[model samples]
Target: MSEEKNESTKDTKNKDKSSDSKKPSRRRSVGIVLLGVLLAAILIPLGVFVVAYATYDVPEPEEVTSKQVSSIYASDAETELARIVPPEGNRRQVELEEVPEHVQNAVLAAEDREFWTNIGFSVTGFGRAVVGQLTGDGSAGGGSTITQQYVKNSLVGDDYSYVRKARELVYSVKMTNEWSKEDILAAYLNTVYLGRNAYGIEAASHAYFDKPVSELTVEEGALLAAIIQLPSQLDPWNDPVGAETRWNYVLDGMVEMGELSAEEREGMVFPETRDPAEYSAYTEATGTNGMIKNNVIAELGEVGITEEDMTTRGLQITTTIDTKTQEATLDSVEAELAGLQEDARAAVVSIEPGTGAVRSYFGGDDATGWDYANAGLQTGSTFKIFGLAAALQQGIPLSAMYDSSPVSLPGDIVVNNWDNSDSGYTTIAEALKRSYNTSFIRLQDDLYNTTQDTADMAHALGVARSLPGVPATLTENGGQPYEGIILGQYQSRAIDMSTALATVANGGVWHETHFVERVETSDGEVLYEHEVGEGERRVSELVAANLLSAMEPIAGYSSSALAEGRTSAAKTGTAQLGDTGQNKDAWMIGATPQLSTAVWVGTADNTSAIFNEWGGNMFGSNAPSAIWKSTLDGALEGQEVLEFDSPGQINFGSAPNQLYYDPVPAYTPPAYTTPAEAEPTEEEASEPEPVEEEPAPAPEVVVPEVPTPDEPEGGGIEIAPGLVIPDFLTG
Candidate 1:
């Protein structure tokens, strides 16, 4: 019984052992199944995510488009650009078909060979990328396809990382699913950077080849494609050799990829030179007058353009520059100032009357340095233009009379004429036509001192005050004040001077001067358009007409003038520094129906003159006059000759008005004899106001009629058209 029981117990023990062994195997099998299930769970979801993202369709990127440039309309070459208003900054969009096939093929060959077949990221390429990242050796190249690149540009910024790459891969899959192959190609071309300030293949092709993308030759296409890999590094301009090698590499790749026939590849010839004009939206002039460059830079702060924007970021500047007019202006100044640079320095400015566009500007400078033309300098007789305007705004007229003799101011300042002599009496027009210094000084004391008229007039004409009485550093006579208000002594830029002159030309309208006409995105969207605004009128039309007419004697027709044949109105000035015999400033401000310009000739140091020599002839007419005449003749070749219209205020149909001032005594004074007759001549003694031989046909008066006071009140003035008192020469 014990043995049987023991056998049963042994059997039971064996059964328990057998059960434990089976339990161990079962647990192992269960563990194996659980591990397999875990593996399957992770792999299945990952595969689904990958497949979904890769196969998921995404909307195509919007086509890149650019705004169009309007054709310019103008006969003047200088205003050529002004005629064709460009849609400011443009952004070009390139189509896949527009891109040369080689360009597409080369980019694919260089960037991703398996782009068509791969699922965004090639497994072999991904492995290579991983190894490359680990070893810090991205030189092994990238595996992201063009579509991936486009996706990265669109979705991801510029961060290059494994995670970003993974995201890009997913986006690429979606992009491929959503966009067609053509769309992807367009996006790639649109996003790629071409050198020479270009952002895309289209802009690049335009820049490098001076043609549209579709017109690119295989060589040009290859060169551009090569630029995409590293624009700055492979730029043909800055890195010609490297770019050439890279270009050849692209060609070789195209050949190897069978994208280019052997004959086409063999025919390829790399370009040796790059013309900046090809890409620049602005037409370039080899003979550009760069005098305005300095002033433009000096006032960049005022103009709202950063220097960095000019140097680094590609900027398409559609300036208010008229190359032909600019050339004429420079030539005029150059000719005018020829051989007389030693006596004084001169500058010239020309502005469009209504638009404030700088149609013609000439600042003296070599091609490499700062332009002194725009430098703020002491204005001599030109200031009278504004001064007269001031007095006229107060109802003064050309017939107004003034004492033409020297006058002593509060500071005992006694001023005289250029010859240091003065006439006993003169009219407002006579004072201006003679350019009498004493007359203007007394006029200033009388007209300006009472109502701040000089200041008002200066401000009205766009003359900014000198800082705390300090003038421009490069002014005549070191910014000294002078008694001759008629003779300019204040400081201002040539551009501002041009604008001021233009105000008269535009019938008292003051438009802010501008260099840029419009701004637009590369795509033809108008960002900004400038408008003309009326500024403070320095004088009424009658006053301006009076002033304009007063300037007529400056041409050669007048005894004291030099400029000939040109229907021009002008003023000349020679100002010496007060209290010092040092610096002298010379100027010629003149204009025609087609243009208004100012010419200044002097040295930067204020010491040298145009000819490095001196004689009696130092006024604007000597050198500056010649230059102005020559330039004007050449520039006005095909244009009709026209003169500024008399102000609308003048009514010549009215009855003759009496003289504004008392007439001089009818006796000949003994001391007022001419130099040739220091002693009285017998013939003069016998001469008499010979009885009027029948009414000697009323001598023709050259002056235009002054406007009546009733004209639509433009500036602040309201007085009748009768001869008024002349105050410019009388205190």
Candidate 2:
């Protein structure tokens, strides 16, 4: 009985220990269950919040719904120079059916393999993209579906930020729901950027292959699809190797997508592309087309048409460029300068004197992107016509005489004839015909208004009254009209000079120069039409006639004349490069009764001299003159040779007192000798006695004392009252 009781107590103790172990295990299980419940409570709501945040209300796509196209036309209003289509609404949009099945498949295979079945956002793609952003690897991965990419590119923009990504996600879902798959695909194809400034597939097709989209082969379509990755980098013209590699990749992708078979891919080779020059009008901003485009844009701005209006409102511009004249001018310059040095450049501008219409122009090389016709350069002796006009306006006749010898003026300024070849005295007409520098300097000084009046005359005639590249302080004196003003020392533009000379040909009527004759909308509504014959009377008809008479001999039968039988008046100019001892610029400006033209030849660098090995040193009378002659002859081939009207009679005052005289040879008479015979008259002794009574006082004469210029403190010559010779001239 005692052994049985001890065994029972041990069994009870074992049960007690087992029960205690069960208590802790039960508690652990309960704690795990509660923890799981708490996690679910937090995570479910957070996931909902994320989804709600990314999928909230999205704005409608309004920008791509409407679009327009702009066109530029020549003077005839029939020839199209250029068509401007921006990257957004201005691009050419086509329907989904219009895109070839293979082309659509290529884009789908390259961009999104599961575009047809996948949701707007893929879970795997999103996770990978998040990882990429966190790892700081830009090219790591992208989570955007076709719809998501469209939203990012068109709506929220491709900003690498969490907020923009969330917005893109939201818009993508909304866009997928709101727009059909076909609509989304069409929008993407139309809005995407391709190479060579192309905005759409059709434009890209034309840009790369010079063909329409419907004409593209399967290989061409694949090439365009590859460019979607990076358009500028994969341009076929600029990067053929990269473009071909990407094209092959796209072709392989098409094979994997079942759109193209392996056999088809194997047979296809990278197609050859047209040269970029073939599509230069679309790719470049430097050519004849570029000039028209740029000028059209500028004119649109002048009339308060915004650039947005130009691209989106579908404007059609009509220019005043006569195609025949423009071609002739360009050909003449290129032909005349065919053998010129590599850096040499030339420009020409022609205008209708009556209408102020810019008929023709050549602005350096077509690819230089510089409009030298509108650019400023030293005018040289071409500016002398303005001074001559000033003199003529003040009743100074062509017969006014000036001593052509070198003379000293106020402030000790010295003027000399060209090559120091002294002509004793010359009339105004003779001085102008020979380009006598001394005569013009003296004439400017003798004028009542001096250089100030000469500048005014230039302004009236149509030259820009201000000198380019001059300081404000110096330009204050009517464009710094110092003694050099008479010699064309100021900067002037070819267009301005041509227009000014045209004023003389137009009988003193100064018309504002312009290039656009009219502008119209695509619907044929005239937005602007330039009025003709609007000009101000800058000079009397008499003064204009007198000026023409003086200039006639310049284009008469001389070697420098533009045409032998053509009634023309012209002046030649050559300016020295700053201290380089080389002639840098050469010019020839002339006018018929109908057209006025100006030509300039020089180095584009503005530093190098225009030296010719075969022709010796180039001058205004040679190359530029020849170019003008050729251009005018071609431009006015069938036009009538209008006669310049004769000038009305005007009486100039009597000849002024001679300010200078040549020194006569000194006379030394033979030494006085005693007279051989003396014959005394009775009146000689009587007259001597009467003269001794009173000596009449000699008439008093006043001679103004001229002050000599003091030696320059710093090694410069003070040429005028406050003007100093620039360092370039001192050398």
Candidate 3:
């Protein structure tokens, strides 16, 4: 029985051992399955990343080419005034050795601290950028190294997309492998935008400091380095404060990077920059250059050559600007405005009436960037010619009568002469010669109550372009008619005035004014040639002749404006600056048969009185007139003088009887009154005693004659035959 019990226990023990050994094999199988799943999880993304990396083809860096510059010439196509190049790629490349060590170090410290140490890709920077994007934090950091920035800016462009970023990373690595670090740095420094239309370190140094890159000090180098981040915003000319702040940041960065010590930075100050306009390349340009260039570009566009093509293809532009006339115009204005206030500025434009060619123009004292001749100021009384023309067009003869007295309009607006004098009855010729406000207003009311006819006349005569501060829809006939329209309460350009006067000189024919006469490619291929078109007739020759006859007397009124030995017609204007009662803009517009010229004088800020002691207060007949006459004399020195034709006679019917009169008064009291008590004691009374008569019969209330509804009264004067009105008696 004992032996049987022992054998059973041993059998049970063996069975238990077998079960334990089988458990180990099952556990190994489970471990192998989990390991395979883990490997798949890691390898799938790696495979995808490797495939994406293989597909991104890095582009080869393009060789930098020197930019071609375009030359600007005067009307003769020989006198060069300036050269134009693309504002973008205007770079002056330099060797790395030519760049100061401080400049290179400053740039590296401000832009990329790990420029020399890091590989093409910065793992920490990339991770920070990824985390920032996921967290919606834009200011977290930038992931570009110096090499990456160069590759992105030069090879792939600065597009902010995931695909672009991926391409930038791939290309940056390839560029690092293909080119040396020094070569990449040289290219990067040569391609960056600085300010004032300068590109690269050398150009920037010259533009900002007026020095070469080799001569740049540590402080200047730091400032230049800072500008690469925000070129336009940090430009010293535009934002001095922002530029200084960035400059200081760059200096501090250099100190932190051990390129500059803290002690060394203590004595450093932000260097002063040069005036953006004083740059030699820009100083040689005139204010009219911008206007001329714009017109040339537009002309080029018509011939399928764009502005880009002109900049890149090295085109030569020939303008209609006569260099002699331009120099004379500029010199005359500058000389006339010399002793005046510093804020005083003047613009002059001369045009050939027959061809609508812009012969010469002076925009202002500083004429490089802004074209003041194309800008607008209030037209003042010079606009009255349009109203006069409209009346003449409607057969209202120059002999038409008007009341040159204080008058009121529909908007409680009162009109009066410049000196507050009144001419009871005056002929249209005398009214226009005197520039009487009430006369033109009444003529406009009688001929066309709405300003449409006058506006049409003005537009037809070339006052069609809209000005900056003026509403675009403003017209004499359309939109809301201003009360001061007849008196020139609108804005107009100097060129517009010149064009209008030229049209009058050209027998009432209107032509579109233009500056560019021709354009050619670098190889001398004629890209554009101006073809003169038959001008549109805007007014009758007879009406224009009559207008000229009326204007002829004005030129002789001012000796300074009178063109000696030359027949001319002119008008003067002055506009009050808002409610300040100070004259803001003064103008003189006139033309001979050969050339038309317009002159404008005002302060640059549009404030300050124009007619101070230095400048006489003769409205437009003073400084502006002198400038015009001198410019015209120089511009047309050798040109032929043409006489205006005599105006044909027109019959003016009998004068109307509707006239303005003073209302009759009803007398209530005598001139002197005596007390009843002192009447007899008259030793003290010298005058006659008043009778206690019944209130001297209320003097008959004389009601003035009221004209019929068709004939409005009290606005203008009536003309009667054989009425010889003296100039002293008239306003």
Best by lDDT: 3
Q: TM-scores of all models? A: 0.67, 0.63, 0.56
Q: Where is model 1 poorest over a 10-residue stretch in terms of lDDT?
A: 711-720
What is the clash count for each candidate, in the order shown?
A: 65, 0, 5
Pairs clashing in candidate 3? 286-367, 287-367, 423-731, 451-476, 452-477
| TM-score of decoy 3 | 0.56
Give me the displacement of residue 544 in model 2, in angstroms. 3.3
lDDT of predicted model 1: 0.54
Q: Which ten residues in a row have the lowest lDDT in candidate 2?
A: 708-717
lDDT of 1 by residue, 23-106 (tens): 989999999999999999889867967885766456546542223222221223234322111233323564577777777887
- Model 3 spans > 4 angstroms off: 1-66, 88-291, 294-304, 368-370, 411-413, 469-473, 476-478, 613-618, 652-731
